[model samples]
Target chain A: MEKFDKLTGIAAPLDLINVDTDMIIPKQFLKTIKRSGLGVNLFDEMRYDDDRNEIPDFVLNKPQYRDAQIIVAGDNFGCGSSREHAPWAIKDFGISCVIAPSFADIFYNNCFKNGILPIALPQEQINVLMKDAQKGSNARMEIDLEAQTITTSDGEVFTFDVDAFKKHCLMNGLDDIGLTMEKAASIDTFEAAAAQSRPWV
Target chain B: MSPKTLYDKIWDAHVAHEAEDGTCLLYIDRHLVHEVTSPQAFEGLRMAGRKVHAPDKTIAVPDHNVPTTLDRANAATMTEDSRIQVEALDKNAKDFGIHYYPVSDVRQGIVHIVGPEQGWTLPGMTVVCGDSHTATHGAFGSLAHGIGTSEVEHVLATQTLIQRKGKNMKVEITGKLAPGVTAKDITLSVIGKTGTAGGTGYVIEYCGEAIRDLSMEGRMTVCNMAIEGGARAGLIAPDEKTFAYVMGRPHAPKGAQWEAAMNWWKTLYSDDDAHWDKVVTIKGEDIAPVVTWGTSPEDVLPITANVPAADSFTGGKVDAAKRSLEYMGLTAGMPLSDIKIDTVFIGSCTNGRIEDLRAAAAILKGKKIKDGMRAMVVPGSGLVRAQAEEEGLADIFIEAGFEWRMAGCSMCLAMNPDQLAPGERCAATSNRNFEGRQGRGGRTHLMSPAMAAAAAVTGHLTDVRDLM
Candidate 1:
């Protein structure tokens, strides 16, 4: 896990709603267990044509937005499927943060686990950010996870809510396995007791 | 002491420890692994130099991305990428000392179906899988949910998950289902009401007369789509139906152990004074043969109704409906029954069991598929396939101009060779209707096995009641 703190980068605007995990990274591209190679195939179907040519109109393919490190997307982003590959692809593509009106629950949680900041903001706030993001390469968006604020190039600011525990983990680059191992003694005791009482299960 | 809802009861029973920040270490009793999602988790485990903490508790099966055709009998015959994923899982399971069911094994099936069928999913347990449809195991009164690959790795390394308690919801459906209606219809109706995001942050416990009256298989069908309603899991109290299904299975206890398990399972229900964060009630009689007309599962309507106009909706909903209608190649106000389909897919984790196949077979018996229509029946498991053949259901489907394929998740999504071509329309017995889910530019209508059979026979979205 990588620590998420303050980041300033060009933001890309993707205005499609209910952008599901399948659209983020189609199932066909999810074959590799390694997370490193997925960036190229992120949104493979939507990003490429039959001849494997980049679709010129896709937000990521546009020359100005090709190096975007942030995404201002539509509501209900990552709505279907629980593939963590969606976040893996997004992070692998170098998009450190995703700002949307809302997100599917699993995807929202997975982002933190994968070291990507998923910021849920009001639709009005997203509208302002989306417009700001359309500025592409010339403009940069600043996000401070510790401050819970996103600042635009023109000085507009928005705040978002995240779970306190999740915030601490993201700041420290701690994964759940590391957290669980912190209470290994408690786990051992509970398992021993459970074996005596609920052995069959 | 406060009375606990079914969700709370099962959740509390599984808590290994509770954190000050509201996180709980939930000890998972069973871990279901599939080919598509386990590879990365395994890679993470390898990278971290960790081994599975409880190998005996995990069951691995390769279903997704495997070729289900008869000619592609082995992994070598599958596409290079698919074979690699499946091979990685096989190797990982072997290396980790976990039990695995390969494609050559008759026990190999969809993880959700295989868990219950093999009795690995017992009452009052916690089950997790990397697949969203893991909620299907909640039918057995277990607290089961789909986890991200990272959490899958966490569970493998620790045999526990750090989870916050989910809000509780009681969705009580009273009255009996009408003759032509089934559990699939009830679930679709529920998703339609709740919308895709309605059950977010909640674990729904389904109760009431209609639910109690359903068979175990039907209950599984209803619980399987809890994720479609944005719920992490759905629960049903354990009863004789659950006990009956569990008894005599490979992993189920016998003799003294069975009696002891039965006593605990009987006590797994919510008390009369149980509390829930929310309660929703729908009359079972109100449900009909339902089908999703749009991309999301929540975009459903009764088969007898006409498509709703996008302009009739408000705000962002209007745009969404219009976009969906455009992708589906449908017009507002068009009768659902009038929308012709190009194919019918009768299989998936949602409705690919023996009972589901029997329902479709009854409708297809002595009847041929509509002219120029393509239809196929893929059972959920190899055991289910054998059972269907034993019952001559496969013969009926084959005689009716339908392809009888081997057991695997065929046409549920486009990972394998079984998929719709561009611009093709299908009546699918699968869970999702997401854009290009079946194939690029493919359109899907989510419905029950009987409804899909009816559509196959009529060449469109026909109500099963009309066929009856």
Candidate 2:
């Protein structure tokens, strides 16, 4: 888990709705057990042509947006498939925060576990950010996790909401497995009672 | 006190601990694992110096990366990438002491299908898997949903998941389904009305007379697409059909334990006064055989309708509709039935049961599919494949010029050797129609098995009723 207190970086705009996990990291790249080396294939089909050449019109392939650390996207981003590879690819590509009008449940939960911030703003707010993000390298936005605000390059500020526990974990780089281990006693108690009552399970 | 819904009862039963912030530590009763998602999770566990807390409670199967060809011994027919993934699952399962169903095992199948088949997904349990369709097990009155790889590792090492409660929703299907309509139509129709985001924060409990009338397999089909409807899970109350489906299976309880399990499962339904944050009512008679015309599952319409113009859509959907039409190479206002297809696929966690095979076979009996078009029927699992063969459904499909292939989610996501070529439009029975889901630049029109069979015979998207 990487700590995410604040970040000021270039923002890339993905102007599409219902951008699914299949588009983020296609099924072909899912063969590896390791999470690394997927950044090259993030949005593989959309970013490349049949000859394996980069499609220059894609925003990430543009000179200024290559190192974008934030993505301003459309409604219901990451809607299909419960692949953690979506966020793994997004993080591996150096993007830590995704601002969307809404997100699917599984993908939203996955982002927090991987130290990425998924902020859900109203459509009007997203519209504003989406417009600002088209400025390419000039679209620098400051994301402050503690203040819960995103400041655009032109000084427009927008506030967003996140679950408090998730915010706590992201800010501190907390390891969730270790935290769950701290409650081993409660889990042990539940297991003993459950095994005695419903032994078939 | 407020009456508890079916979801509330299951949630309460699984809470190992609750924080002051209302965060819950949920005890998972069954963890279904598959090759594609577990490799990374297993590697994470090994790197962290952790041991599986409850190996006996977890089950692993090789499905996603498996070749559907009959020569599956030692993964001989698979690509190098697919073979390594399947082999990784075998090694990880052995090293962690979890139950592994290799490709050669007769019981090996899609994780969701195999769980219920082996009676691992019994009623009144909490089920989690690394795949989105884990909601398929909710048909048995269990609280089931998908988890990310990180959560997979969490469940493996702790057998507990950190969680929060979801809102309760009821999708009550009223009246009787008209002839030619099936459970797949009901799910597709529901998604059309719900717009893919309607059930986002809720665990929908599907009920009413129509739902109660469905068999266990039908119930599973409807619940399998709960993810496509934007819900974490969907469930049906356990009935005699459910009990009959689970009794005497390898993992089901025996004798007195069975009786005890029955008593508890009987109580796993919503109370008469259960609270609901949202309720969607759809007439079963109104739901005709349906198909998705666009990349999103919500971009669907009844097969009797025509393609919709982008301008006819409201809100942000207008842009999405335009993009979808361009990607599909379809024109607005064209009759859906007039759109020809290059291929037909009939298998997925959504509609790969024996009943699905039977429905497709009934349509294809004594009739050959239109010439020069490719078609295949990949059963959900080996047992499903075997049962289809025993029932002569496989013979009918073969006689009708359709490929009778091995199981393991073939062409559903195109992870295996089976796939569509670029620009090849297909009439598929899989759940999602997302862009490049089947293959890069490929197009998919999602439909029921009977409808897919009709398309194969007609060389276009023909309504199933016409064939019947």
Best candidate, TM-score-wise? 2
Determine the iRMS, in angstroms, of model 1. 1.3
What DockQ does candidate 1 score?
0.67
| lDDT digits (tens) for residues B386-405 of candidate 2 | 99999999999999999988
Task: State the lDDT at B396 in candidate 1.
Answer: 98
Expressed as tens digits, the lDDT of each residue in A100-141 for candidate 1 is: 988888888889998999998988999899999998898999
| Candidate 2 local lDDT, A1-201, one digit each (tens) | 999999999999998888899999999999888887888999998899999999999999999899999999988888888899999999999999999999999999999988899999999999999888888897689999999999998999999898899899999999899999999999999999998877878
**Which ranges in model 2 have alpha carbons more than 4 Å from their true place?**
none
**CAPRI-style grade of the A/B interface in model 2:** high
Q: Which residue pairs of candidate 1 clash?
A: none
Clashing pairs in 2: none
Measured against the native two-chain assembly using Cα atoms, what DockQ does each of the candidate structures obtain, in the order listed? 0.67, 0.85
C-alpha displacement of B261 in model 1, angstroms? Answer: 1.9
- How high is the TM-score of chain A in each model? 0.96, 0.97
